[model samples]
Target: MKQVCLAILTALLALTVVSPASAQYIWLDKNNVKVYSDKAPPPDIPNNRVLKGPRGYKAKNIEVKYTDGTEPPAPEAKAASAPGTPKPPMTTAEKNAEFNKRRMEQAEKEKKAAQEEKNRQAKAENCERARAYHRALQTGQRISRTNASGGKDYMGDEERARETSKVEETLRECN
Candidate 1:
């Protein structure tokens, strides 16, 4: 009689071990808090945002909200999960790759900004040089340079006129 009773108890326990994936609902409310109940979650909650199924229903995807409502102070809001609940599945390698990608992008932006500053400085220097040349040409002083034969060659009318035009063009471009 004792053996028969033990066998029947074991059979009952075995029969009750498995439960169907129904009769429960798990979702996040507008406040980004998780709610678990036998009834359906709020209608504002999208189907994909449901964390668990109820009554033969399953969400096609599970999305964790990372922000408050839909308004943005940008990514200031963080996703809230229940204490002692399992966290999202993410591998270390994927996290490392993402970090490296952002680092590279930041470095690229710095490089481009530095290049623009360098170009701006170079333009300023060129403009200063052009202004100095224009001033010297307007002074009416006799300009001379070393000739190919190492003799001082004074400025002639035609050559002076040509140099004046070149300097004027440079001034225009720099200004």
Candidate 2:
């Protein structure tokens, strides 16, 4: 009799646990207070929430109007110019010239940015080469800067040798 009752109770518990009866979520409200519910949160809620769902769930985007009581001062009207120092209104030619100058300045800035990007890429390539040289040196291979027949290049022999030594030191110490 006891075994039969235990089996029936276990079956009932399994049935109840098989599926969720309701979905629930917690969200914040306009005043930044947390709220919990078993259904879709109220539209008046300040922030959206994530709720457990069966495959698909819609996200709620809640916007709140909040204000801190600080306001900016109003703009003051400009004082009228003195009689001898009259203000000149901008003319069409002057405006066009100013616009063209600004456009040219922006183009120059963009060109400089592109040049800097190229320089960075070149530096990265050089670092890769340094790493390769270091690896070759570590594996007991002789790798010089270049053949002597390449002529006097921009990188002097002393500087190239110094750079390679630095790479070797870094590889030995760091790795």
Candidate 3:
């Protein structure tokens, strides 16, 4: 643990000492936000748009061009990115954003799974009720119910048929 802490302190000291000695590029991003980096801005960015660049590397040397107005770059370049131009390591803010994005995606997946389980349970319940009602109708026994006026009423043949059809529809949907 002592060695680990010492190593971390040394690394941090090295980084702080190295960073200030490096040349930095400054420009406004597409969102019109000022950005500072250790790399040059995109080639297409206007020379005037580049607020600053490495020492002895004048920003006015840039030439803006758009090929899309005529033709696109070869697919090979897009498929196999140019070699030796490795992407820079992610910054702290970028790492945090990526972590948040993954976390939100996982949450969304869990939410969807929970909803599907709830729907499945509801469907099973509906199927069970429909099956029970179908069994009762098939018995052909007189089915009675209390009317809205609190009087006992019996189901007629037409009412039974209508109910059977409705239950059949519900069964079909549940299945």
Candidate 4:
């Protein structure tokens, strides 16, 4: 029983080491069915259709062996720097500048909200006026408007019809 357990552990360790290097490549065949394999597809397959395999966990130090028996080039090591040097702290002026920028952004947001609310109120008032005019025209009430010369002029039948159409258009737009 001990020997069997040991063998199973060894097999698991072997799989863990080999699985990452054997990440599968996937692509669609001519029939549009997905095909998966460890090796690259045939040269006839378009490069665009080939999907890259999932990335696997890599060890800090992994060695590659070439089948041609040639030694790989050595990697360059980075020089370590001294640890005592630290980043400079922010100045008071810098803090104030950041605070001012945030304040300006908040102010702009408040201004935009106020403007949108004002526009909504104006639209509501205009809609109410249009509805009132439509109701008056339907009731056949006398409709009059001040001309550019400041004289009260009663609307003729054609004028009333045009006004009714205009009010109807306004109502449709507002609603």
Stretches of candidate 3 off by over 4 Å are: 1-84
TM-scores for every predicted model: 0.49, 0.37, 0.51, 0.46
**lDDT digits (tens) for residues 1-175 of candidate 1:** 9999999999988777644434478887655578877777666567866888755774444344656576433222333433444456569998999999999999999999999999999989998987887787788788899999999999987887888899888878876
lDDT of each: 0.76, 0.63, 0.83, 0.77
By descending TM-score, how would the candidates be arranged? 3, 1, 4, 2
How many pairs in model 2 have backbone atoms within 3 A of each other, for residues 3 or more apart or on separate chains, i.e. clashes? 0
Off by over 4 Å in 1: 1-90
Q: In lDDT terms, which candidate is top? A: 3
**Model 2 regions more than 4 Å off:** 1-79, 82-89, 142-164, 168-175
Q: Write down the TM-score for model 2.
A: 0.37
Q: Model 3 residue 152 lDDT?
A: 95
Poorly placed runs, candidate 4 (over 4 Å): 1-89, 147-151
Positional deviation of 106 in candidate 1, in angstroms? 1.8
Cand. 3 Cα-lDDT: 0.83
User: For model 3, how does the per-residue alpha-carbon lDDT over 50-112 read when each residue is reduced to its tens digit?
Assistant: 888866865544433576675545646843675644455689999999999999999999999
Q: Name the Cα RMSD for model 2.
A: 19.0
Clashes of each: 0, 0, 0, 0
Writing each residue's lDDT as its tens digit, candidate 2 over 26-61 gives 665444456666676666432343434334656554
Clashing pairs in 4: none
Give the clash total for candidate 1.
Answer: 0
